[model samples]
Target: MKEELLKTFGAQFETPLIEEISTVGKLAEVPAGETIMDIGNYVRAIPLLLSGAIKVLREDDEGDELLLYYLEQGETCSVTMTCCMGQTKSEIRAITETEVLLVMVPVQKMEEWMAKYKGWRNYIFESYHNRLNELLLTVDNIAFKNMDQRLVEYLKKKSEVTKDNCIRNTHQQIAYDLHTSRVVVSRLLKRLEKLKKLELHRNHIQILEL
Candidate 1:
């Protein structure tokens, strides 16, 4: 399972590295509403989110949390990568329960792998490229799309093909996903709910009609 999860990083590298990683790292189960890692906390590894959901958030000067979409199953967390790369301090947190397969690559191991395996380097680069593309698309959406359109489009895109249903992403989270204020999201969600298009439950917002 770990091997296949890492395979999503790229097709070039051998999945056997997951076994090697297992020797050096460990698996963690984070319960609902738990903080897997906090902003400004330094961690020296990359985590493959094996199950459940995690959110990336940025806090405002007033100490309010802004939702930054989520890192869903099969998707690795960006804060983990940034920390591993020794970049700026992370400003994100896990917003939901999650299970992660952690891989810690020391400096020596990084150098050795880069020297010994071209495929390994290709795999890492590819993962970064894909992340950049996701970021770019996000930026483009925020710049060009209206709030209603963006929110509806995000729901449509994330909905399951079978029933066109998606996980109950919260209003605040949707506001963050749209890069808008939660008050706006609240108003919009109220409007959507009134239209009989969605239903709200404790900590969850379900789309009732596509």
Candidate 2:
């Protein structure tokens, strides 16, 4: 665990900070599609991604979900950090996008490290800034972009995060992430196919132009 932690975060974190994380953080491996955190759940820890990716999502009262952003290796969720600091329930859900390896740092350590480590403080602030930008981008896409354009951007993001041009999520799953109907997603996907942007398969999508 220490070696993995160092390999993932050593460049960004001070030696002492890395040592502290290795000593106190719990290593976890989660499979793809597993929900690591959910709305209304009290956050006990913040995750530091070591490998793979996790997608953070927001949910409405109607139970509809929209993907906020993806956290890849060496990234942490700022929203989760906020919840930990406030001792509040999570407003978003975090799910594994692929098999993931991460280190879970207890909530208390978050504050402790902020005061003790400059690297930790910088990391926390940077996480917040990056996440805010992503949230704004999501809003812009929904408000200004067409459904097809949003879908194409979403696929491009997914492909980038998973490091694969072939997307394995179903149309319905993509609909849930985009906060739209499966029928709508399917229709848009077919349109994209005809436009030579992507090729739709029975269970996966192969990116072409996107």
Candidate 3:
């Protein structure tokens, strides 16, 4: 665990901070599509992703979910950090996009490290800034971009984060993430396929043009 933590975060964190995390953090391995955290859940720990990807989502009152952003290896969730600091329930949901390995650092340690480690404080602030920018981009996509454009961007983002051009999500799954109907997603996907942007398979959509 120590070695993995150092490998993933060593460049950004000091050695002492890494050593402390390895001592106090609990390593967790989660399978793909598993919900690691959800709305209203009290966050007890913040995850430091070591491998694979996790998608963070927001839910509406009607229970529709929208993908906010993806957290890749060597990243953490700022929303979870905020919830941890505020002692509040999670307002968003996090699901493993792939089989993920992460170190779960207890919430209490977060505050201690903030005052004790400059590296930890800088990491947390940078996380907040990056997440805020992503959230803004998501809002812009919804407010300005067409559904087809949004779908294309979404696919590109998924491919970039997972490092796979073959997207395995079903039309319904994509629809759910985009907060649209399956029929709409299917139609757009078909249009893209016709335009040679992608190829539709029985279970996956293979990128041709990205």
List per-prediction Cα lDDT, in the order shown: 0.62, 0.93, 0.95
Q: Compared with the true structure, what per-residue lDDT tens digits does model 2 show for residues 41-133?
A: 999999999999999999998999999999999999999999998999999999999999999999999988999999999999999999999
Alpha-carbon RMSD, each predicted model: 4.0, 0.9, 0.7
List TM-scores for all candidates, in order.
Answer: 0.72, 0.97, 0.98
Give the Cα error of residue 114 in candidate 2, in Å.
0.8
Point to the candidate with the largest lDDT.
3
Query: 1 or 2: which has the higher lDDT?
Result: 2
RMSD of 2: 0.9
- By lDDT, the better pick of 2 and 3 is 3
Query: What TM value does model 2 have?
Result: 0.97
Q: What's model 3's lDDT at 14?
A: 96
Per-model clash counts, in order, read 0, 0, 0
Per-residue lDDT of 1-210 in model 1, one digit per residue for the tens? 456446554355555555555565556666666776687777655666556666566677766664445666555664566566675566766555343333434433554565777766665576567667766776777788877767776676556321336455677766765667889888877787899888867876788884
Residue 4 accuracy (lDDT) in model 2: 92
What is the Å distance of residue 133 in model 3 from its true position? 0.3
The candidate 1 region of ten consecutive residues with least summed lDDT is 99-108
